[model samples]
Target chain A: MTDDSIGAFRDELIDSGLVIDAGVEGLYGRTLAYEEIVSGIIALTTRTGAGDGAMAVHFPPLIPRWLLERTDYLKSFPDLTGSVHTFGGDDKRHARLLALVDGGHDWVEVLEPAEVVLRPAACHPVYPLCTGGPLPTQGRRFEVQGWCFRHEPSADPARMLCFRMHEFVYVGDPDGAGAHSELWLKRGAEMFESMGLDVDVVVANDPFFGRAGKFLAANQLDDALKLEFVSPVSSTETRTAIGSVNRHQDHFGLTFGIESADGEVAHSACFAVGVDRTALALLKRHGLDPGRWPAEVRARLWP
Target chain B: MEEEIRQILEEHGRLPVPMADLDNNADLYEAGMTSHASVNVMLALEDGFDFEFPESMLRKSTFESVSAIEAALTSLVGTPVE
Candidate 1:
């Protein structure tokens, strides 16, 4: 598929006020795109809430190291987490460094290790909370927007050092988990369909662990745990995975000991939507046309 | 170059700010810049310079003022912008 459309759509996003101007090199890096996308989801979620009790959740900007530690996040993907650290020094030392730099010295500090790592994924905390408490009824679900951080130096504006991740997490009986994923995969399709974009729902893979990631890449043809609702971004990277339905098997349930009222092992699943990516995808698919946009789609998104 | 950066920040709601406010030595954060303002400033820097602001540079001290951000950016790009 020629992605001339995605590039046009990207330009349209900047026009729609969904994206601030792409920086110096333009689309390659240093652009801002958030306002339009957030409002778009707000409109979509409101539509979903008309018949559902899906409460919106607000989480902290950063998650704790302990929260990520239990999940073996570092083991799974150490490359992404960002940590905060400070140099161990008295005011005098700090003053001295400041003095040198004031005198045109190359002032630098080695600093201590980071105390807290930034949250890379939106669902890390949700699963832990599920584990601590009893599994409620068979069909409880929740949704939230998490501000995430990544330590990538790619300098791609399409990629961000920090980004907002929207996730609808379903945890409860095993069957309920399946139901949530099934419903969202369809729901996500509907959202894209409404936007007049060509969308594909494909079984996709996560950035798996270690040397295994290379192994998984070779079989890019296979891998069932991933279901990505993909739209084209660049011709080279067509699958802009806006959302994914993940079956955590029993990994989270086992770790958190979350159980059904009847004490059966609970299951866990999540639908993660890169809200920013979705806006970008819309830009790629729909050329920034307020007048040309379907009234119903505009009403659903803008109103 | 600094004037252009300041003008961009001012237009983007880096309020209580004047065209002449962010001198080369003022500590913008200590002078009471808000986090939201910091983000806006970061956005402007990105657009103006075609640079990405790393999380490592999000500290209160980094946006201390025009000079601070310039220093941070200098280290990042490894040169002074004349």
Candidate 2:
């Protein structure tokens, strides 16, 4: 999309009271009306038999650095990771920090690293919790909702640095994991199509880091392990990945020592829906006014 | 050309098997070549062969095997080959 269109869309969102201008690129506050639509969309999409027996888990936005280290997140996304830092200054240092802030001289240098880093994805925390044992005979499923942070800052609202993801994760044997992801791929497509959005399910991969990451992305796509449900959010020509169904074959299982009931390293998969991006997609497609949306679309989201 | 491709594979493909042992049409991924490694190979190929891969040729199929890579290069360079 052109910069002009993106700027216009941002203006429309702010003018319509759907998005509050936080003055920072890639960061915006959601108004109550926008939040009501987001909550309604989440409720509608998550109303499913897929998560029937899934265990619900809630995670804080910040995860332990040790846990993140175990997941190879630091290795793959060193550039995008955010660590929590706090001021650990004595009186003298505190006085210096105050002076720096007062003079607007970038006082952030005084803050020391906390033990936790902002969580980058919704599924990483689930892997550690399910460690130390084999899953049940039928496998295990979990439903998680949490804020995720990335260092990416862009003018596009859909590419927010901080956003909430509602994810459903499954751990089991390879076959079960594959089946679960495939099912979600289909369900995710149907869910968005029913919502009146033209969605494309495409083979995709992560933005792995540096020179080696290029091959990683290609291999992931070659393996057909990652599928994205993309829709036109910011621009019609450029689609955004609003949801993704990923099949991680024994990667997490081996790292966390999780096993399947059959005595092999378990395979894992997760389907995550970007809640805010979906809301933004709705606004982009159906216009800023919800009243002008298709009758069925309005009913499904607002009713 | 084959030797050049093999050299690129050896340097950047990170294949678990030796370059000589890999079949011309064998799936590179099956031999433990990762996506990250494939990207390195792609860049190496572009540099060694003096050709740029278009967006259409950037998918997994383009780097699936030695034969596939050879084909992509031949197509990009627009030359006949075995």
Candidate 3:
């Protein structure tokens, strides 16, 4: 989409009460209707054939620093990671902080890094929780949801800095993990398409850091490790990847000491849906009035 | 031709090792060229050679090595490597 269209779309979202401007770029508060639509869609999507006995876990927005370190998130996306920090200051330091703020200077210097960092993704915590043991012969599946934070602030309403993701993670042998990812790639497409959205399932890669990361991206694409379900949320020409199915072949399992029944490092995969993005895509595609959407679509999400 | 490409790699490739030390056929990405840096190299090549890389030529293999880059440039200019 053109820059003008993207800007207009952002304005439309605010004007229509779909999103309440958080006064910060890439941060938004949803309206009650918006939240209902997103939550409803998430519930409906996750319920499809979801009776696989997956463990449901809800995580806080912050993850421990040591756990994040083990995931190599900082190595790949140091620019996007957000760490928690707080003021651990004496009364004298507090006076200085107040003086700085009163003088219109930066006062946040008093804040020190805390034990936790804002969770970058929903699946990072799942790996650590499942570590130190071999998996069952059928493998383990987990359903997790959380608010994830990244530093990529943008005017595009689809790319929020803090958003929710509903993910299903599988840990097991290579074949199971790979097949799980592949299955979800198809299932995710069907889910969106059924919602009357034009969906494209494509091979994709992560935004790895630096020059060495180019090879990593190429290797990722060359191996088809990531599949994204994209739809035209902001622009018709450039579809946004609203969700992804990723197969991390033995990467997480080895790092966290998770193993399969064969005593070998397990493979892992996750299917995550960008709840906010999908909701925005619905609004963009079907117009601001959800009541006027296709009966089937409304029934699917709101039913 | 190799020297010219090496100049660009050294200036813009952002490899860990010096461009001079890299083998002509060694993969630049393996030597530390990232996707972000490769875009810089691509732009530099375009400016130096006065040609645009076609979309079809924008694959990983096209910039895998110094030789591959030289080959892509050769094809773009429709002439033998200098």
Reference-based lDDT, residue B81, model 2: 56
lDDT of 2 by residue, A1-303 (tens): 698888788888999998887878988888988988788777876685344588888899989989888776765678899999999889999999999999989999999999999999988888887777778888888888889999888888788989989988999898889888878888888888878998998887678786445546656766888889999998888998999998887767766779899887788999999988899898888888777889998888767
Top TM-score prediction, candidate number: 2
Task: Report the number of clashing residue pairs per model.
Answer: 5, 5, 3
Q: Which of the two candidates, 2 or 3, achieves a greater TM-score against the reference?
A: 2
lDDT, candidate 3, B1-82, per-residue tens:
7787889889987665897787879988767575556766877888888888876665678888988998898877876644
**Ten-residue stretch with the least lDDT total in model 1 chain A:** A214-223
Per-residue accuracy of model 1 over A1-303 as CA lDDT, tens digit each: 344654555465555565554353233232334565456765675475345565567787677778777665664467776787667878888887788778887665535655576888877777666665566685456777777876664323346566678877777887887887788788878876776656789887556445423333323323265588887653335666777787664456655667765676677778777766666666555544444567776677777
Task: Give the alpha-carbon lDDT of every model.
Answer: 0.64, 0.83, 0.84
Of candidate 2 chain A, the 10-residue stretch with the lowest lDDT total is A210-219
TM-score of 2: 0.80
Give the distance in Å from residue A213's predicted Cα in candidate 2 to where it truly belongs. 1.3
Model 3 misplaced stretches (Cα beyond 4 Å): B1-82
What is each candidate's DockQ, to 2 decimals? 0.01, 0.25, 0.07
TM-score of chain A of each: 0.79, 0.96, 0.97
